[model samples]
Structures are given as C-alpha cells and as structure tokens.
Target: MPPATPDAALTSATASPQQAAPDAQGGVVLAPVAETPPKRPRAPARERTIGTKVAGQPAFVLHSYPYKETSLIIDLFTRDFGRVALIAKGAKRPHSQLRGVLQTFQPLSSSWVGKSELRTLTDAEWVGGMLPLEKTALLCGFYLNELLVKLLARDDAHPALFDHYVSTLNQLAHNEPATIVLRKFERALLKETGVAADLGRCTSTRAPVQADVTYVVDPERGPRPERASDPWPRVAGKTLLDMEREDYQDAATQSQSKQLMRFLVAHHLNGAPLNTRQILVDLSQL
Candidate 1:
C-alpha cells in the first residue's frame, strides 16, 4: 500500500527535525507549540468599482421632464435594458448637446452610467434611418410611448417587444393604418409583459375558440364565453384569432379588435387613463 501523505493543512504544521528535542529516555519529542489555524484565503482585493457604464445601446426617449433649472430627467426605452430613467444634466439649456437629440420617437444610441434606478445620460447619437413620424402618426407615436411607460417595468428587457416597437414606428412612418398599427402594438405590449397571451383560446374551457362564438377577454385569463349581461365589449372568436395572427384588414375584425384591446388595456390599467389615447380619442383622430 502506498504511504499516506499529509494534507496541505497538516504539512504546514509539520515541525523541522532541528525543532525536536532529545527526551530524557532517548526518543526525539517535539516541544508543544501553538498550531497555526489554516489562514482563511482572503477575498481577492475588490477592484475599485465606480459605476456601471453602458455605451452605444439602442434606445428611444419615451419622455423627458425638467429635472431642475437646467436638467431633464428622461424616460428611455432601451432595446437591451427595457425602461430606464436617466438624468440628462443641462439638457434644458439652449446650447446643451442633448436638447435636440433627445426627441421622442427618434431612434438614438445612448450611453449612460450609474448604480441607481435613475442613471446619468453621458451621450446620445441619433441613428436616423426611419422617417420622423408626422401629423397623426406623431400623436400615435406618443401614444405608444405612453403605453410602454405605463405598462413596462424599468430595467426589464423585452428584446422582442423592442423590435416590434421599432417595426411599428417604421410602419406608422410609412402611413400604415393607425387603427391596426396601435392595436398590434397594444396586443404585443400585453403579450410581452405576460398580461395577455393565447388569444385564440377560451379561458374557462381551455379549448380552441370557435370562429362564430362571441367572447369577452378576461385580461387575467385569455378569453371567456360572452354572458348576456356582460358589459365588456364582446368580440367574435374569429376576431380574437385574427388578433393572434396580427391581421386586422377586415372591417369587422378592425372595429371589434379595437374595442377588445381597449377593454383589456383599461382593465390592466385599472381605470388609469392613457393620455395619448385620450388626445386622439378627443380629436376623433384614431
């Protein structure tokens, strides 16, 4: 059998032959000495961390408010970081670099740094490929931003939804029907947040929704069979399936889907009004 080797802990404590003393009987005995406890490996020296620095991330300014005399606190929807609040110092000053570049609905590559929920905006560069949303589309753009700010939690990234937002912006810029465009974005926003999904199925039965049957969206659940006295908007199951497919070209689908989505979003908001929606609705623009 191979001789057993001392553990590293024991090896560190082994005495030198010179340290052993001659006993009265002739055997060499080591004098008792305090055994050193194994040194706890010190945690590696922490690098002096200053702050979390993010650079050249794709984002859009959802909204910005005057933070103080010369600064603005911005609500930004970032592709990778979801919703973020950033303090753009000196942004309100006439000569400030961020004043023109921080416009809402414009795609921007922004850099920020800080450790708190509200970060410091270090830089912003416009990445202009899509056209600026104009006229009615412009209001619709603000509507989208309002919905996101209302629904999306900060620092929660929804990459798919972000891509959809960019696509919706492009579509709006190109003069796509606003009704369909807004409905699609609303549906997608809900789906991304797990507030709505499986729109083509029924909530109670978990069965495939029939095209001809009327239903009401439960918001928490998917869809429920419409009851006689139900006040919520009743939508045909076909309309629900059309929403699932993102198709709203048909007049009935277009009209019915709008009411359904409006109810669902309102339910989730718990009567909190969408400002942009109110503006568009007041003007009979949407």
Candidate 2:
C-alpha cells in the first residue's frame, strides 16, 4: 500500500465502476455500453431444376378436375409409375391439343416434368383402344377408378396391375358380362395390392379346398369352414377354383362369383360404399 502501481490503481478504479457512481438515494448506477447487433444467417439457395422426357410410357387418365380458368388437374395411371397428378395448363381451352386426348378408359402416352409429387403435363396422345366403355360398363369403369384412388398409393408402379386394368377395360368395352369382368378385376386389384389371400388353401389348415365343401370366404383372412353361427355367404370350393382360373363362363360360377367378389370388396372398403355401383344397380332395376 506504500506505492501502489498505476496498473493496480486502474484495475481497482474499473473493478467497482458501478459503485463509483451513486444516485441521490445512494443506489449504484451502471453506465450502458454499446452492443454490436447480431448478424442474421443467410437463407440456403434453392436447387436448380432441369426437365427430362419420359418416353414411350403407357398411361391412362383415372380422373381429371378443373384447375384455375384454363387448366386441369389430371390423375393418370401409368404403366410404370402408378397413379400421378399432372397439371394440364390451357387444357380447358376450346382448341387445346390435349382436349380430345385425355379421356378415361383409353390408353395413352403422356409426358410431364417436375420433381415434386405433382408434375406438369407437357403432352398427351391417345392410343386407340379395343373400344370405349358404354352403358353399365361406363359405371363399372368408374368403380375401377375409385378402387385405384382408394387403394393405390401415388407413384407406386405395378406393371401387371396396369396390364390387368387395360384388359379389364377392354373386356368391359367388348360387352363381356359386366359381373364376371368386374369380379375378375376386383380379384386382380386385391391380389396386386397384397391384400388377397391364397384361394386354394384354408387359412387354419394347410389342406387344399375340396371342390364339394361349402366354405365361408373371410375378407381379412381367406376361405374357411362355414360355421353354424357366422352369417356370411357360403361359397362352394368349385366357385372359388373357377374364380382362381378367371373362368366365369359357367352359369353357376358366374352367379356365385359375383356374390363372392362383392363380399370381398365390401370387406376391404370398410363400409364406405361405392356410389357408381349403386348407379349400376339402379339402372339394372329399370
């Protein structure tokens, strides 16, 4: 303490800087220091996009809806890409090049772009089909669309199902019995979606279904015994076998096959009704 250094004095002076000043009430007062504002981080740049062609892709229009004033939002079922959404700019115009090309139940080759789930449709060219669906078949075609919409996930390809759908449409267009064609398609749809069980064997026992035995068709499961308590339709093993072969020619097979498919489809639909089916029923009633 005899000769305090200048460094020690300066340190002692600044150490109690707050206490150095006092208000009238004897409360310590602190001086404000200038603060540098925090710098904000910059945003990341967006990825650059380039369009490419999807050549010779087989596709069909599942459904289309109006968009804006001059465009349409088309849901396409492609051979290799499953269900896809495409924006058809200017498709609503009176003379749009794609106006006549984008139609349901008709085969098509479509081109589009964009990496996002919803793509832009650049072109659509119709490939002539077996024929256009009419009468009861028209409503049945919509039923197929509804099934695809409800069951199939977007952009998941099923080439075999796509082929089956085309063949089903052709059968309907050619006036193959409505019920038979529908049953075949429904079976194919369920099988392709991985929901259908083995038609030949019992779920409980590994035994093959005998042609004479009466069995109960379980929707979630496969065929089993027709128990005394359960109220579901009891189908013959022969009927099930006929369905497996897609042979609906026999009168008995056709009648029973309809009931079987309807039961199976209703089970998977979870009580949500198909309105197109009701239309077909009503027309048949007339």
Please, what is the TM-score per model?
A: 0.83, 0.78
What C-alpha RMSD separates each model from the true structure? 7.1, 11.9
Model 1, 104-166: lDDT tens per residue? Answer: 888999999998888899999999998999999999999998899899999888999999999
Compared with the true structure, model 2 gives a TM-score of 0.78
- List the global CA lDDT of all models: 0.88, 0.83
Best by TM-score: 1
lDDT of 2 by residue, 175-208 (tens): 8778877888888999998989887888779788
Candidate 2 local lDDT, residue 40: 80
lDDT of residue 206 for candidate 1: 89
- lDDT for model 1 comes to 0.88
Model 2: runs farther than 4 Å from truth?
A: 1-53
Error of 1 at 253 (Å): 0.6
lDDT of 2 at 159: 92
